[model samples]
Target: MLNEEQAIEARATLEELHVEHRDLDLVIDHLLLSPPPDELLVRRLKKRKLLLKDRINQLESALEPDVKA
Candidate 1:
C-alpha cells in the first residue's frame, strides 16, 4: 500500500499525464486537418501519443493498491 505522500504524488502525476494526453489529441487533430500534412510530424505525434498512453496505464496502476486474493 502506498503511503499518503506517495498516493498524493501519484494522483498529481496522473492529472498531469491526462492533460498531456488532451494536448496530444489536439495536435493530432490539427495535423490531420492540415492541407499538406507533414508525414514526419504526424509520425512523431503518433509515437508521443502511444508513449502517453503507456504512461497513463502506469499511473493508473500505481494508484491501485495491492489487493489480497
Candidate 2:
C-alpha cells in the first residue's frame, strides 16, 4: 500500500514514462522510414520501449486498490 504522497509521486512517474514511451515510438517509426534503417538502433529503442511498458504495467497494478475477497 502506498501513502498519499507516494501515490502522487508514482502517478507522476507513470505519466513521465508513458510520455517517453510514446516519444520513443514516434522516433522509432521515423527512423524506420529513412533509407537503410539502423537495425541496431531500432532494436535498442524497442528494448527500451518494452522495459517502459513493463514498468508502466507494474505501476498500474500497484495503484489498483485492494479488493476484499
Candidate 3:
C-alpha cells in the first residue's frame, strides 16, 4: 500500500501519462492522414501508447479500492 506522499506522487505521474497519451493520439492521427505516412514510427508510437495505458491502469487500480461480493 502506498503512503500519502507516495499516492500523491502516483496520481501526478498518472495525470502526466494521460496527457502524453492524448498527445500521442493526436500525433498518430495526423501522421496517418498526412501524405506518405511513416508506418514504422506510427507503429512504435502505438506500442508506446499501449505501454503507457497499462501503466496508468496499474496505478489507478493501486490508488482505488476493491469491491468484494
Candidate 4:
C-alpha cells in the first residue's frame, strides 16, 4: 500500500498523463482527416500515441494500490 504522499503523487501523475492522452487523441483525429498527410507527422503521432498509452497504463496501475498477499 502507498502512503498518503505517494498516493497523491500517483494521482497527479495519472491526471497529467490522461490529459496528454486526450491531446494526442485530438492530434490523431486531425491528422486522420487531413488529405495527403505528412508521413513524418503521422509517424510521430503514432509513436506519441503508443507512448502515451503505456504511460497511462502504468499510472493507472500505480494508482491502484495492491493488497499484500
Tens digits of per-residue lDDT for model 2 on 1-69?
988998999999999999999999999999999989999999999999999999999999889998899
lDDT by residue (tens digit), candidate 3, 13-54: 999999999999999999999989999999999999999999
lDDT of 1 at 4: 89
lDDT string, candidate 4, 1-69, tens digits: 677899888888888878887887888778878987677987898898889889878877777868689
What TM-score would you give candidate 4 relative to the actual structure?
Answer: 0.80
Instruction: Tell me the spans in candidate 1 whose CA falls farther than 4 Å from its real position.
Output: none
Q: List the residue pairs that clash in candidate 3.
A: none
Candidate 1's TM-score reads: 0.88
- Put the candidates in TM-score order, highest first: 2, 3, 1, 4
Compute the lDDT of residue 57 as modeled in candidate 1: 96
lDDT winner between 1 and 3, please give it: 3
Model 2, residue 14: distance off in Å is: 0.3
Cα RMSD (Å) per model?
1.2, 0.9, 0.9, 1.8
Weakest ten-residue segment in model 4 by summed lDDT: 58-67
